[model samples]
Target chain A: MSIITENNDIEDIKIEGEYDGIIELDQWFDPKAENSVLLILNQRIKLDHSAFEALWNSYTIKICADGAANRLFDYYRDSDGKRYHPDVIAGDMDSIREDVLEYYEAIETTTVIKQNTQYSTDFTKSVNVATLLLLGIDLNAVEINEYDGIHKLYQQADKSQLKDIPLLILNGIDGRFDHTIHSMVQFYALRRQDPYFKMCFLTMSDMIILIPSSKKGYWLKLDKVKPLIGNCGLLPLAGPNIITKTKGLKWDVEDWPTSIESGNVSSSNRFVGENCLIACEESIVMSVELKWDKITQHLIDESE
Target chain B: MSIITENNDIEDIKIEGEYDGIIELDQWFDPKAENSVLLILNQRIKLDHSAFEALWNSYTIKICADGAANRLFDYYRDSDGKRYHPDVIAGDMDSIREDVLEYYEAIETTTVIKQNTQYSTDFTKSVNVATLLLLGIDLNAVEINEYDGIHKLYQQADKSQLKDIPLLILNGIDGRFDHTIHSMVQFYALRRQDPYFKMCFLTMSDMIILIPSSKKGYWLKLDKVKPLIGNCGLLPLAGPNIITKTKGLKWDVEDWPTSIESGNVSSSNRFVGENCLIACEESIVMSVELKWDKITQHLIDESE
Candidate 1:
């Protein structure tokens, strides 16, 4: 069945048939999917239990970034008494509580690596750890005592063995504004260096994903994912000015001049159809509103 | 006593003497200042009592944007049974509760205007209301039944009577990403039309202000304002790629190229001296950390 609609400038495409050579963007967290990794940053905002559980079930690997260990410890303390240990607890160890560190040390499930370098953030350190782990690097062989341990691990990993893995970063946004922006910068940096590293930041309110300029006719299948409540935005947050053409939006634009300055840019545009196509001249930040009740309902359905 | 330090590329400038023709960016809220205005948006986060009180004491006019009236209502419900009425309650009456509308109606102190226009957001509506109110436009003289009532008031407002007022927007950030970005877009739009409308978004964590590209040798006097906790960031959130030079930051850059994309952009950079100088090739978002305890202490001092 198709529900296509056409106006003067806007066209709604209902995604049904399979397309050739389409790169499916991992914007949703499916409980059955195992290709994604979860990286938790420092405790900026409280994680919703249902959302966290859903994410925990979907990801293959989970790593805590420095002080994030304390947050994780507190989260799992009262529930089942069984520690939901992460594969790695990595960062400069500045904000990580001593007791929490000892708890992780006592329970040999988590490897705590202290990267004391001030040049890079703890979140970056965690990303490096995930990169090394994905590349099948032998953790023991890598020097864990050094300040740049993750960097060493990255160097030792076989270049051919590296695979593109999707990462879902939690506590990434809604914190200190600088920290949040740094995370976005890392997203741009990592993707530019390695095109395969697909990442999304999950905040308490929304999910932020980068729609790269390389994908000219990018089709976003909204019906395939969980339902969102309100409107989404195409944010020209970084880089140069971008000219965009969009379909399936309430106020769809053709050859729209969008930049960070005064007159242009689409901020409160809403998706009107099941599928949307976004053609951008440059990469920009696109965020979808997260319906918390719908996510919780999905978890309930999965359990049943 | 000046403490100017230099490394290979980084330089720290100790602000000792005042410079000529410098516009002091209203990045900090002083309880003593009476020329500021506070505009409250829809309730995304709880307003800290101390912070709110401090802001309440500082600003000359207080306006509530649509659903923010509900938040203001709840905030004053249990405390001393005294109502904190706003000068204007403006927005599309979609999200505003019926009880809130009636309560304001019962108490004739607040003017509730129903702007049913979907073209502009509640924030923008509130801004328009503030503009009209500032111009001494008698509400009785203007027709308030129409959808674009405030816009009409603006048209009737004498051009010579318009004043550039500083605004402090509360609950403006850290909510839905689309809403936050829209607020920012409005900031750019408002300022472009009138160079005098200085505005800042005050969240629970940080204060966001735009360092316009027009101001080349912009020197930020950090010591004159309330003390911030830690570092600040120069976010190239909007606009084209920018080349920047700075003094008085922990990692000050000299003629550094910054953009929204990969390798550049200064995020998580810290202020190292009492005053900082930023010479930006283009306008960028600058955020400074908020010291909650210090703000609360100031409130306590005022009370004593």
Candidate 2:
């Protein structure tokens, strides 16, 4: 018996096998698709080299948000004695070290764009760059002197060409609580404006995906390559209480009423089956534990 | 001009002169009050020695949640050459190293309780133990052999004797995202059942507090000893959209309507004044960045 949605509409949103394309990066590589962009933020956490390399190889564009350039430089400097340059280096240029800035600027292939906008964050700037680049907007045509270059580029870009691109945001979580919350806010904001853009937040520990409540519901099929490591959670972080029904969980809920106030938020819940079906009354954040062993194995394979 | 809440009646919730007491631990010590408890969880982040020592000195009760005993033992093994034993070591015997467990057990002052309950988390078990211990319940009367010993003790404790003790939960964040969210759920659960209990989550970087909306509102005063390091944020994590009015921030909002869906959540905002006043239409999570310099200075003072 396969997992079914709350409304029993299993035929409509039944995500069978791995080809559903529901914004998950469990597979090692997507050679056919090259639209995904990996955005790196300036949080000082020991990023998994294997995970970084996997996303790097999978995605078409790699952009570093400010000081993340320094991190990338340092990461590769010690590991392989090779300078790993991002496709585009964009941010307010505050936290990026002077030497690191020079090193990246000296790289002929890297486009080091200094966006000194106080209104938006470095991560936002990187997202704007990703959108503009994905939309096939000419970098020289867009006015780069303005405070909101990305916003300007976004507004002028051909909307028809702006397809929903998967953005793998890295090092955004597990930082200071404020920054982590800010990233979450951005995640929700981007999803609300453009449902086409699939933004998946990747940390060392887990992968966070925003599961929107729709008439069709959603099916999350677990890939054999990326099995759930420890536990997963369905958090009702945003507005209103979340009434959810799930299948393929160790402790599956029929119609669990969850809210921050009611004290019934589901956390530390394990995935029991290969696939999970979620039917939510309201949009909620669902995160799956990332298996580090599989991720590191990929890294080893890449190095060999 | 001092910051005021949304309501014109500022007299009721005016937090003045750093003594308003809104569950902040900026000061090195609360010499007057010794009722607070420091609950250590098994998340393996490096605990700031100064911050840990400060909290240890401030609170009368120190309890380790399972594998946190291992952390405490490791932290003090090389330094001070003393086996700093917690008053109570509670939680399921899962992650606690065998050597570390034996070390704590050998200590005469520490009461090591093995709570092998699958229903409740280790942190929750520790909380139950804290509630029972703080209520002056006799430990001998409680059935230690049972899985739900703390829960049973909590049931039998005198209601009048129970006090709203501040619990400083350490290393709870930056681990598994599910565990972190679970800890946050517990934070709300404790607050809902008992308004008097003030649960403060402390990390290496920040202090998190939940401010509930009321006719009285809330006032959070900045302390000279505990100055804001980088930035502060007002986050609406759960329930309804938060309509907030604040002061003493770099970008003070008159009336900010923030929701997860709206994408207007305030994060990476700075504190501008000594005191900040908040009037919220709904409960919100507020966090302030901690100064590592001052914290390490406190540690230095202790060592000298």
Residue-wise lDDT of candidate 2 within B42-70, one digit each (tens)? 86647666656665776788899889998
Docking class of 1: medium
| Reference-based TM-score, model 1 | 0.90
For model 1, the superposed segments whose C-alpha errors exceed 4 Å read A1-12, A16-27, A31-34, A78-80, A159-164, A224-229, B1-28, B31-34, B78-80, B155-164, B224-226, B241-243, B300-304
Residue A88 of model 1, lDDT score: 89
Clashing pairs in 2: none
Model 1 lDDT tens row, A1-304:
2122334433456654433223343334653443557898886436667657766776777899988888898886555677678888998898999999999987766888888887677877887788777766656565675678677666566656454467888888888887777777876787765555678888767888887774355777665452544568888777444545666777777666676575466765666766777767777788888777776666545544
List lDDT for all candidates, in order: 0.70, 0.70
Model 1: chain A TM-score against the true structure: 0.87
Best by TM-score: 1
Q: Give me the iRMSD of candidate 1, please.
A: 1.8
The C-alpha RMSD in Å for every predicted model, in order, reads 4.3, 5.0
Candidate 2 second chain TM: 0.84
- DockQ for each numbered candidate: 0.65, 0.69
Model 2 chain B weakest lDDT span, ten residues long: B2-11
